[model samples]
Target: MAAVNVALAGRSYEVLVGSGLLGRVHCEAYSFLEPYGQRSIPVVADANAKRLLGEHLQASFRSAGLSIDWYEVPSGEASKSWAELEKLTDWLLDRGITRSDHVFALGGGVVGDLVGFACSILKRGCGFVQLPTTLLAQVDSSVGGKTAINASAGKNLIGAFHQPALVLADTACLASLPIREMRAGLAEVFKYGLLGDAEFFARVDADSNAILSHDNTVLESVITHCVGMKARIVAEDERETKDARALLNLGHTFGHALEAETGFSDTLLHGEAVALGMVLAARFSARRGLIAQSDAERVADALARAGLPTEIAALGLDCDGAALADHMRNDKKAEATTVPFILLRAIGEAYVARDVELADVGTFLDEQLRAH
Candidate 1:
């Protein structure tokens, strides 16, 4: 097992990465359950994950002299709603779960976001463990401490920064993921490279096949590398007061808008939207002469090589750039006049731009649509 520490002064925590890590949760991750030492773990999982690995987790905890209470919420973005949060809180209350208990979120990003948010507000704060099953969650969302719920206004409009006590990412669980989901996860993995690491991007360029084939060593390395990168950033800027943390949202501004326009439906998975968003951001940067057109092309080409969406045309969403921009106006990042965007000057270096001309945004969006 390899460990990366999220160094946040006193709130520091470890992210443990390896294959079959979930099965060894009792032995490997038991101590992180907070309130110092709590043996009873309330597991919150998506229904599908329960069918796949729930019993094993339950039995593992039970055998460790721990009482395990399992709760199920239907999977997907829709589950990250106020109604679901209220219901889950009520469920925990009925189960006699107190602020001292630890809740294990065992599934993809949705499970992590919801359960982590629930833990944040339950008695103002509680302990939770992230057992990320999807590569997207394992590498990014699961470790960041940014737990959120969707509001009618937009995605992740309601949430908090409640860090997980422990992150146990089991690479073996990824074997059961559908190819589409795996591809979606790769989009986020690719973002780490696009936002700030040319060498990391080069690594993915060379080993994309190994990652796709589920090579245990390669996949574990990928997850650990990405998680470590994220942990370093979050440790420095936990609340995003400075621009340091905002860089992580490189494609998220456009990506979140796409998700909002689609109503967070299956029409566009989060990672798929992020893939297209990164391409658009690169194109927009190129159009503004911030980066070479060749660089944008390279980004689009790399995404296509990974089997991820790289264009608006392929997404089947016929909205014009003006419409997409309208979605951006409502984005959380938008302020009185400018919406801060995480833009790339090159493959590995990204910066926040609050001065991008609105007309330039319109022109780029129109150009992207016309190309499709």
Candidate 2:
């Protein structure tokens, strides 16, 4: 098992990455809960995850003399709404969950975000554990404390910074994930390299096959590396008050707009939109002479090779560049009238570009739309 510690002053936590972690729930849960003098846990999961490893987790916890109360919501982005949040909180209250109790989030990003947000506001803040079952959640969403639900205006517009008590990313869960979901997760894995480590990006280009094949060794190594990077950044800038942690949002500014345009539906998964957004960021950088045109093409080519979308034109949205740019105004990174964009000075070197004009962005996106 590979462990990364997110040393956030008083809210430090461990993120454990390994195979068969679900089977070891007894030991893991006991260690985490013992510190708080708890013997029972409330789990909030999606129906899909319940079908996969629910029994194993229940059996493991039960065997350790720990009781579990499980509540499952329907799968998908639609579940992260006010109505569902109300239902979940009502359920937690009926079950006697208090500020001192820890809630277990046992699914992918949707479940994690929803449950975490619920815990944050429930009784004015409670504890929660992240049991991320999907690749995207394991490497990205699970580690960060930025929990949120989708808002009518934009994605993650309503959220709080409530870090998890612990994150158990069991690689074994990936075996049951659909290929498309796995490919989507790889986009974030690639983003870690693109934003920080050039040599890691080269390794990903070379070992793309092994990574995609779900080779245990490669998966563990990749997840550990990504989690470690995020842990260090989170420790430094837990609330994103400094720009250190904002670098992690390299592809998110453009990506969130794409998600909004697609209505946060399966039409464009967050990871898929991010993969395409990174390409757009690279291309925009090239247009501004920040990077070579060949470098932008290389970034796009690598994502395409990994079976991810590299162009927005392919999404066939019925919107123009100005419309897409309008969606970005709601992004959390926006300050007053300007949005801070994480653009590349070079591969592995990302900086926040706050002077990017929305009109110029619309024109650049217009060119991209016309190309498709």
Candidate 3:
């Protein structure tokens, strides 16, 4: 087992990455639930995840002589809507959850985001734990404390920074994941390397095949490292008031736009959009003389090697660059007239560029959309 701690002055938490973590949650997170002894544990899982991995979690609770107060989150990004949020809160209220109680969020990013947000606003900030079942969630979304539901305006525009008390990233759950989803999760894993660590990027670039094959050693190492990096950044900038946390959005600014264009559906997964988004960000940086063209292509080549979509033209979207750029006008990162981009100076070195003009973005994206 490997553990990384997110150090907040008064709100610190631990993220554990390893195999069999789902079976260990009852022991690992016991302290949080100890205060409310003998009460049935409140756990909300993604419907699909419940079907697949519910038995493991149920056994964990069963061994502790506890019963699960279960709720099922509808599958997909749609669950992060106003209607679903209302439904979740109503259910929690009826379950008699208190601000002092803890709720367990199971499954991938969608479940984590929805339940984390629901807990944040439930009785004005209750506690929650993240049992992230997907590679993307286990490494990124589950650790940052950035919880949200999607809005008409944009993805994650409606949410809060309510950190989870504990995060158990069970590597075992991933063994049965479809290869497509596993590949999508690798996008976020690769983003960590792109954002800060040059050597780590090279390592993953070389070992992506092994990582995708569910190599247990490689999987746990990558997850632990990503979680460690995230822990350090989140500890430094808890609310994103500083640039440390913002740097973590290396691919998300452009990724979110692609997602918005796709209606945030299965047409493009979040990590897939991020994979393409990082490619665009890299190429755009090279265009602006921030990085070399070869470096940009290297980034694209690395992601493509892992079977991710690395080009915008391949998406075959009906919208042009201007339409995609228009989607950015309401991005969560948008200021008066600019949407700050996380641009690369080189591989493994990303920085914020706030001078980006949306019109220029439209022109650049138009070039990408037309390129092979």
* Most accurate candidate by lDDT: 3
If both were scored by lDDT, which would come out higher, candidate 1 or candidate 2? 2
Q: What total of clashing residue pairs does each candidate reach?
A: 0, 0, 0
Error of 1 at 6 (Å): 0.6
What does the lDDT read for residue 107 in candidate 1? 96
| TM-score per candidate | 0.96, 0.97, 0.98
Clashing residue pairs in candidate 1, if any?
none
Task: Give the per-residue lDDT of model 2 (tens digit) for 1-372.
Answer: 999999987888899999999878778867555644443578898899999989988887877777777899899888888889999999999988878778899999999999999999999998999999999999999887998888999998888999999999999999989989998999999999899998888788777788788899999999999999999999889899998999999888889999989888999888998898899999999999999999999999999999999989888889999999999888887877678998998999888898998888898998898885
Model 3: weakest 10-residue lDDT segment is 31-40
Model 2 bad stretches (over 4 Å)? 32-40
Candidate 3 lDDT tens digits, 1-372: 898999999999899899998997789998876776778888899998999999889998889888888899888888889999999999999988999899999989999999999999998999999999899998899998999999888899999999999999999999867888899999999999999999999999998999899998999999999999999999899999988889988888888999999999999999999999999999999999999999999999999999999999998989889899898988877898799899999899999999999999999999999999
How accurate locally is residue 55 in candidate 2, as Cα lDDT from 0 to 100? 92
RMSD of each: 1.8, 1.5, 0.9
Ranking by lDDT: 3, 2, 1
TM-score of 3: 0.98
